[model samples]
Target: MNLAHAAPAAVDEGMTCTVADGWWSLDPERPSQPEPVKVVKLKSLTTGEPGVWVQPARGKLTDQQMHIALRRLSDCH
Candidate 1:
């Protein structure tokens, strides 16, 4: 399994496991450190236009991961 780079915890900027016990580990400085609140940028599926997306007030996420998260959020309602 490929290990993705780990970002700092959004809440406390503490260390987290991106891929626990996986093949690789992320360099502490490589990933973005999240703030207390995070702003996400997304594209509209239908319009194919850029849109503003706000995350759940925290967490560092890549584009693909963010997309999946948004989909999961949409699914809940």
Candidate 2:
């Protein structure tokens, strides 16, 4: 899948995630931390809307993480 745009789910970038490793690391202390290389996708809850993309990085996210992400994405409207 093509990512329209994606950055680290990081505080420095103004985003926060609870995951430690993977793309969810938002800890500003580990500024050198890297997001996964393959895409971690968060499926859409609404019809006709594209899934929220994590980028060209791949990793596992908890169910709660997905829910939070989807909810946040929905708020963009």
Candidate 3:
């Protein structure tokens, strides 16, 4: 696991996960970012099943943050 980097939780901004735990940018310095939402990812890299992507990201996400999160589910690895 990696410490989620300094980035914005904006879909169009960047998804610099290289390899990530989940989609929410966990950088505490970035309070302007959308809260991390707990969601079952359509793909889980570990179990190959859906669940909150731990080993991954932790959060306080919301519906408004969904756009930034959609990509997290598409990760088929």
Candidate 4:
């Protein structure tokens, strides 16, 4: 939750995240599109680390969109 030192550009390969709340609108600039999902980093099943990854929630996103969201979330903190 305290991602003050989290890097926004970190790789999300070995990371896992959970949606903290419902999906939110991305930016007000584009009202037509739904908001990106909000999520919190969860413990990595591979590395056993926690709070190291943060990215937009997945599931609804396509492969490309999920990739992009993962990258964006990496920079969230």
Candidate 5:
């Protein structure tokens, strides 16, 4: 699946998700903290014209982190 550019969904509500071990951690108390990866999916809220929305997420993830996550997800397919 080409996630780089996907057909935008509608402008509805968004959501959040976490990817375990997505980021590096050092705190022993929170060894599994990894990082909080937010996943947003836009849904059309209006009618007519297929809603062209943007679903983006940002957390403790950097460009490299995001690339790695996307690569990992792609590898699953």
Candidate 6:
């Protein structure tokens, strides 16, 4: 899935997943610790799919960051 086209604004609007790509994640948010901005992969409540909910070690992601995170998560499958 090429996330280059993924819009940050769209993410902000709560469209977490792209079913066509079989992946989805939450927007990056500040954590309690001084760490990279984190995004949590969410499971499809209806499908019961397991999510790759690991916190990445990077700060404030650009569109590239989202792409990288998605790629890493995809590799785990």
lDDT score of model 4?
0.36
Estimated TM-score per prediction?
Answer: 0.18, 0.22, 0.19, 0.22, 0.26, 0.21
Model 2, 1-77: lDDT tens digits are: 96443423322222333223443545556643544322255555466334444342233343332322332321120
Query: Per-residue error at 10 for model 1, in Å?
Result: 23
CA shift of 63, model 1, Å: 15
Error of 5 at 44 (Å): 21
Between candidates 2 and 5, the one scoring higher on lDDT is 2
Q: Write the per-residue lDDT of candidate 3 for residues 1-77, one digit (tens) a residue.
A: 97344432332222323224333556766644433343333232353332233223344443332323243433232
Compared with the true structure, all predictions reach lDDT values of 0.29, 0.36, 0.35, 0.36, 0.33, 0.32
Candidate 4 minimal-lDDT segment of 10 residues: 62-71
Candidate 3 accuracy as lDDT: 0.35
List CA RMSD, all candidates: 12.5, 12.0, 13.1, 10.2, 10.7, 13.7
* Candidate scoring better on lDDT of 4 and 6: 4
Better of 2 and 5 by TM-score: 5
Residue 33, model 6: Cα distance from true site in angstroms: 23
User: Which pairs of residues have clashing backbones in candidate 1?
Assistant: none
- Candidate 6 at 58: error in angstroms? 1.2
